[model samples]
Target: MTDNFYMLTWNWLADSPLLAAATEVTTKSDGEEGTFVLAGVLLSLVIIYFASKLGGELCARINLPPVLGELVGGVLVGVSAFRLLVFPESGSLAEDSLIINLLQSTAGMPTEVASSVFASQSEVISLLSELGVIILLFEIGLESDLKELIRVGPIAAVVAVVGVVAPFVAGTLGLIYIFGTPVVPAIFAGAALTATSIGITAKVLAELGELGSEEGQIIIGAAVLDDILGIVVLAVVASLVKTGEIQISNIIYLVISAAVFLIGSILLGRLVSPLLVGLVNEMKTRGQVLLTGLVFAFVLSYIATAIHLEGILGAFAAGLILAETEKRKELEEQVVPLADFFVPIFFVCVGAQTDLSVLNPAVPSNREGLIIATFLIVVAILGKVITGFTVFGNPNLNKLAIGVGMIPRGEVGLVFAGVGSASGALSEATEAAIIVMVISTTFVAPPLLRLVFKETETATEAVDKVQE
Candidate 1:
């Protein structure tokens, strides 16, 4: 009766003359409107930003990576919990209005009402999040000296190959054999598991002040290579699923294209960068260096997209070239603020997209998802751990640390699952399973990384003490 009355009050308020007048006052003229929509987006970003800050600090207090907190913060406000940050849907007022606010504030409205408003602006937010990711990869590339990457090249290649191959075999066989899932879905599971979250690994290494360490360099290099391999594997699996037959030539072409895009970007960027940098150096305009760097990043990102590779690859390549510039330090310093603001948003949005309800055991399908998630997590960990042994450089370096660094699946795994879901190739249960696996990997990797690295530090100290 109380709920019904509340609903009645809301319905009445929604139709009230004063409320309509107030809404009209907020809307703009000249055929443009949606003041409330803009308010909602701003409110969403504010909420996300603070939540991410709180979450990150909390993780630091607990001796975990800050990204872990950011992700959890997203989950808290996302559909999994408070439903504060949501992707709005098109529907009747009732389905959209889960909460009602008489306060006439973006933060106070019905979740669905906000959703409806936000749905119209989702593309804008998505574009911003995409920019955040590009900046992140670019930062990682800037940190990576070409000479360091080249030094670790052989071991990184081996680690990447084994890392990808093991997980692919593990995830595919485990899903098909254990769960009796279809071939296409099993393939997706494998591809998803094979991804190494370079952002997570790089962040963790930087947090530990070990980004320049031998193990760290190997982990970063291997992760980049792993991403390249993962992309090819995904394309091949997707093609196989779509065509219902293996197209060897197409697979070869994709492989070549991806390789050429990565290698070609580096060579071409290096070759032409001096000319570009000289032009920018001559510019007397304010923020010339910053603007020129951004232009270069965006252009490379576009080229990567044209070749069907992820745009971040291009941004990363741009960073690699720019790292060699005389103004590299200035560029890094200038970009830091931009990275700080946007990177957390990307991670939080990732967490927000997770639907924990899918893990409910009471539902038969969700229970199946949970089971698959469990199996995939095991396979994901072991597969990466196996890759550590494949690395032959720096015998004193902790292979386990490298393995742990590679464990997080982050956004790339989500991309694989998303592509599968979007194509209608995966069933709901499979989709949920992949999501569970991705989230599980993400949540687990950070703490494990801290643990392994801490242990390595402790052992080193002990060895030094004994020698002393």
Candidate 2:
């Protein structure tokens, strides 16, 4: 029966013009490229969407930040283990084989059909991921209250400066002394450590119900400033790497540009917001004003990036400037859905890049790599922790908690690692070390915050009873 069917199939192929043309073309030509690319993108999206949702739920159940779940999901998808489950044939094509050569050659073809396939499918997923980050930053900005930051001005500034400087110095010194790595990579690694992940900190504060309190305000305010400073540092380091020369004039320009952008954005927002509100009120369509504000945020973010400043700074500044407007709540409500979808993509992508398979318990035997990693970790921790000592006034406030709150490295660290690796400033060992620092910072912040906040709550309850 199978032999007869094969004969019939051959007869049909011989008789049909389309089938014969397709067969002559092979998978390398126009025949199978669409199918493979479509499959790859669809598979990626399904995995990402489910992983994000599952991670969010798991994080909440474990009393940890939902970002943790997203990170874990990213890791699962990135690792060889998960890839095998999804794409069993990936990375396994034998050499000198017709199928493998066709797949490889066809992959590079600039055919209209292939481009259309990528644009229709893969491009959308990539765009959604990018949009997720933009909206996420906008929401972060919307949630930020500048008045609270102003109220804690001096303290926040001090904390931010100390926080940036300490880890930077310690990290650089550790690399130079312990690893004997080259100057550029060491500087890059140290710079990566200097960033503090305020998102994790903010989430913990909200969970602890301290987000509206004075101390909480101070920490959040400092973190905002810290982010600004961190970006400036990244810009400077990047400039140095590119030119092989760090100019004092360039550093001055960067600082001035950042300051001007921040002040100008707020000033412009203040001037425009009244008119914006009036327009929104007149329109009365659901989310019209909020959508307008979001567009404005994106515009400002684009302008900032054009001027060599971080686009997120502009997005954040726009949010802070508009925070006091009457339309703030409406804007927040309108933007929440967009934020919910895209933000997890940013976190998951970050996690996906982390390759933990290379991390070994026997790293110590690697001598230099192990020592450098350990030293960098210690420097990363202590430098940020000591920033708590810089907290002025309120001797009763837990500076340790504030310092610990600033520990996670987040996107900023990844930026540094990417720049360093791309520029050939970092070796594999150094890059791995930086990744370890990021992982350590992310893992440590939540539990430490939980314990500190718990103790603070107990103490507050005791004090309230005493006052009564």
Model 2: lDDT to the true structure? 0.72
- Per-residue lDDT tens digits for candidate 2, residues 1-468, read 999999999998889999877778775554465665655465566678788789878988988767678777877765423531121112222232222233346555344454344444435555566566666667666777778777788888888898899888878876787668778888888898888876656656766667666667777777778887887788778878889887778778878887788888888889988888888788857768767898789888888888787676777777877778998888888877777767766667656656564467566534455557788788888888888888766888888888888888866676677778788887778877787778778767877777777888899899999999
lDDT of all predictions: 0.81, 0.72
TM-score of each: 0.88, 0.81
- Residue-pair clashes per prediction, in order, are 2, 1
**What is candidate 1's local distance difference test score?**
0.81
Error of 2 at 180 (Å): 2.6
Worst 10 residues of 1 by lDDT: 94-103
Quote the positional error of residue 426 for candidate 1 in Å.
2.4
Would you list the clashing residue pairs of candidate 2?
132-342
- For residues 1-468, what per-residue lDDT tens digits would candidate 1 score against the true structure? 999999999999998999998787656331132655565556668878988999999999988888889999989977788766655421123233222122144344444344445555455566778889899888877777877888888888899999999989988998898889998889888889899988877877878888878888889889988888888888887888788887788778778887888788889888888987899889999998888888899999998898888888888888888898887898888888989988887888888777788878888888878878888889999999888887664679799988888999988888898789877888878888888889888999999998999999999999999999
Q: Which regions in candidate 1 have their CA more than 4 angstroms from the true location?
A: 1-34, 88-116
